[model samples]
Target: MSFSNFLSGLKEKTNELKDEVLKFKNKNFLHAATAGSALIAMADGSIDSAEKQKMLKLIENNDALKVFKTSDVISSFTEFLNNFDFDKDVGESKACEALNRIKDNNVEARTVMRLILAIAASDGVFDQDEKIVAIKIAKELGLNPADFEL
Candidate 1:
């Protein structure tokens, strides 16, 4: 490809990503989604490197989250992760509340739950602790545990 054509393609891809980001009507949805995923990552206690990568990968591929900037997602996840690390009681309470915001939107809530579960299983082992966290997140989102095979 010519230099100009390459630049054009790059610009087009950039615009597409920008449009996707703009398509996100509620930015809080991004925050809530990130927080929800972070909760699951910490469910098994400290998020191992592999688990962390899985969480990021899930967020990157989630249809509901793809509209967001990767950095934004990482920042939101960090905030929640740190909060939970600092104080499990207070942090979990806050994260759950944030997730509750999407309770009225079943589609969005389900998407978040699926993403969380995917992240939990990303390390190749969905342990008991991860399942517990997934259940809690499902409940917070007003979803039935049975729906997610919890």
Candidate 2:
């Protein structure tokens, strides 16, 4: 009921949100990496060796996701990639879950989508399959695929 008490509570809530955003950023980066790699791999029926190597390097070098074992990240990405073969929709759903985790952080979803778009285009030509998946992911994250411009 007191003004001072309300201000204190507001500060506490803000701090809590900041902490949650930090955690969400980490999770979002991981998911974006996973989704990006999957799109590249599924681009041409098979993921090229060069693309695989790049994906692995990206995951290994990202400091925020360092908490995840190299093997764990690779395994998770691979699982999603495999799912892309049997069911593209399922693969997109998995990627959406990763993006959704950070949606509460407001801008984190868009940031993650930007990362995904960059990776999708890293191979020079954006593969059609990957582009489709990226658009699906962007929409799922409440982002505009038009922003990525394929």
Candidate 3:
């Protein structure tokens, strides 16, 4: 193969590697946000269509999360939901595990809390159950629930 051709192939491979690294770096944030969304959605014992739609829109619009393909976000959210459906305690444990991944990062934790609050209120009523779940999430993140008005 010509040197030029080899260089071109190397560049292409490098670009692909960079893309994969970027995805990996953002994967935790994506999972955490989606897991929190699932928790808030299921807080009231029923996931509302409006809440689902709001989460989709948020994923599309949020700069940090928009880097991820929608399919990945949806899949993560679905997995959380399925866990909840299969067993409430297991689901919550899994979701909390994901959330705790970024707990030490104040900025990311606050962002996740905001997304959770938005999802909880999307149904037009941030009910007591939702509030309690949000508060729990806030505490798990080492954040003050009152800071989020939870």
Candidate 4:
């Protein structure tokens, strides 16, 4: 191949690799966000329509999450909810595991915490049960619950 063609191919390959890496990172974020949302939404023993709508709105407004389709986001959220429906203990364990993935990154952890808090208060009343779950999620993300006023 000519030098120009070789450079063009290399550039294309680099862009493809970059896109893959970005998608992987976003997927991790998506899982963590949805897991936190599910935990908070179910904390009070039920996931209300208000809570679901709040989460959907948050994802729609968040630049990082907006890259994903609404259906994809809903699917992820539903998957977490399904896990909880199957078994509370197992669901919590899996959700915490997902949150732990970003614990080392303080920024992402804080953002996730913020998202959790928003979901908790989405129904106009952040009750004790939701607070307790928020605290657990904060600890899982390596954040202090006190920082979030939980």
Quote model 1's TM-score: 0.81
Where does candidate 3 stray beyond 4 Å? 1-16
Better of 3 and 4 by TM-score: 3
Measured with C-alpha atoms, the lDDT of residue 148 in candidate 3 is 85
Q: Model 2, 127: alpha-carbon shift in Å?
A: 3.8
Best model per TM-score? 3
| The 10-residue segment with the lowest total lDDT in model 2 | 103-112
**Model 2 lDDT, residue 10, Cα:** 100
* Alpha-carbon lDDT of model 1: 0.84
Taking the tens digit of each residue's C-alpha lDDT, what string does model 3 give over 66-93? Answer: 7789999999999999999999999999
Candidate 4, residue 147: the lDDT equals: 96
Indicate the worst ten consecutive residues by lDDT in candidate 4: 19-28
lDDT of 2 by residue, 44-140 (tens): 6666766677677766766666666688778778877877877988876776676677666645566556656656666776767787777777776
Backbone clashes in candidate 1 total: 0
Clashes of 2: 0
Arrange candidates by TM-score, descending. 3, 4, 1, 2
Q: lDDT tens string, model 1, 1-150?
A: 899999999999999887866656756677778788888888877788887787778778877667777888888888888888789987898899889998989988888888888888888999899888889999999999999999
Residue pairs in clash, model 2 = none
| Stretches > 4 Å off in candidate 1 | 1-24
Q: With candidate 3 superimposed using the best TM-score fit, by how many Å does residue 24's alpha carbon deviate from the native?
A: 0.3
List the candidate numbers ranked by lDDT, top first: 3, 4, 1, 2
Q: What does candidate 4's lDDT look like per residue over 17-136, in tens digits?
A: 987777677887888999999999999899989999999999889887777789989999999999999999989998988899989989888988998899888889999999899999
Better of 1 and 3 by TM-score: 3
Report clashes for each candidate as comma-separated counts: 0, 0, 0, 0
